[model samples]
Target: MDEKNHIITSPVMGTFYRSSAPGKAALVEEGQAITPSDIVCMIESMKIFTELRCEHPGIVKRFLVENEDPVMKNQALIEIEIH
Candidate 1:
């Protein structure tokens, strides 16, 4: 059977951060396994930081945005292939 891929999206408009802080490793990297409760990234809006989680267990396929990139609500952030 073909592998099913899922797209993880942003829930709010904000600045997308791949790492917790500058000069740090990203929370999730491409091809990394992730769980539903995993904190994949963070979105900062209005001076508040919000942790974004993966809704399904899968392997991260690709990142749609770069670190510190501005993102809009509902924008695709990452592609995950379901396990």
Candidate 2:
């Protein structure tokens, strides 16, 4: 099974921030290798920060959402090519 189809998705409804905090570098960028425990981004909801992690290790292929974009529950955030 390929990992490309396994895409990283959002957890809950909130605003998706590329970085952990505002004005900081993004959590991961294109071509970056991310592990299951690695944080890809953070979703802020009700004033709570939620870390979004990958389900497997892979190289980032695309960012489905732009910085400071609103994301819905279970939305596709990024696509990773499973290695």
Candidate 3:
């Protein structure tokens, strides 16, 4: 909740994927500048993949969840530092 940090949370319970598809690049990396509209990750549930976007502009500080990791609703995915 700190002003310098912004957390990206999972909206649903599912498997988290860092890339858009298998063997693709992870959407954003640590220290990468990002905008509110950037796609940060994906959550797939019941064969449905949901694109997760940033709500605040910042640089990605770290990823809290790993690729293919099961995430719960509202689980923190990544942390970013607001620019």
Candidate 4:
């Protein structure tokens, strides 16, 4: 089987968060296995936080945006190697 690269994009324009809160373990990390229902990250807009879920099953290759970085809608946030 061949593995394909999949880009996970931000669904909304907001600040990206790797963890639920500061000083907390990251929700997901590089090289972590992820499922379609997995919460990959969080985005905060106007003080409202939204959980960003994975749409594909794969291994997290890397994060395109750093934590607390502002991202635009449809901006690539993570690179995943599809299972």
Runs of candidate 2 with Cα error greater than 4 angstroms are: 1-3
For model 1, the stretches where C-alpha displacement exceeds 4 angstroms are 1-3
Please estimate how well model 2 matches the true structure, expressed as its whole-model Cα lDDT.
0.84
Question: Could you estimate the TM-score for every candidate?
Answer: 0.89, 0.89, 0.94, 0.89
Better of 3 and 4 by TM-score: 3
- Against the hidden true structure, what lDDT does model 4 obtain? 0.90
- All models, RMSD in angstroms: 2.3, 1.8, 0.9, 2.4
Pull out the clashing pairs in model 1.
none
Cα lDDT listed for each candidate: 0.88, 0.84, 0.91, 0.90
Clashing pairs in 3: none
Q: Name the candidate, 2 or 3, with the larger TM-score value.
A: 3
lDDT order of candidates, best first?
A: 3, 4, 1, 2
- Writing each residue's lDDT as its tens digit, candidate 2 over 1-83 gives 26355577778899999898778988899998878988988999889989988777888888889998999999998888887
Q: Tens digit of lDDT per residue, candidate 3, span 3-83?
A: 888888988999999999999998888889999889989999999999998888889999998899999999999998988
Cα lDDT tens digits, model 4, 1-83, are 13598887887899999999999999999999999988889999889999987777989999999999999999999888988
Q: What is the lDDT of residue 8 in candidate 2?
A: 70
Residue 57 lDDT in candidate 2 = 84
- Please write out the lDDT profile of model 1 over residues 8-51, one tens digit for every residue: 78888999999888899899999999998888999998888999
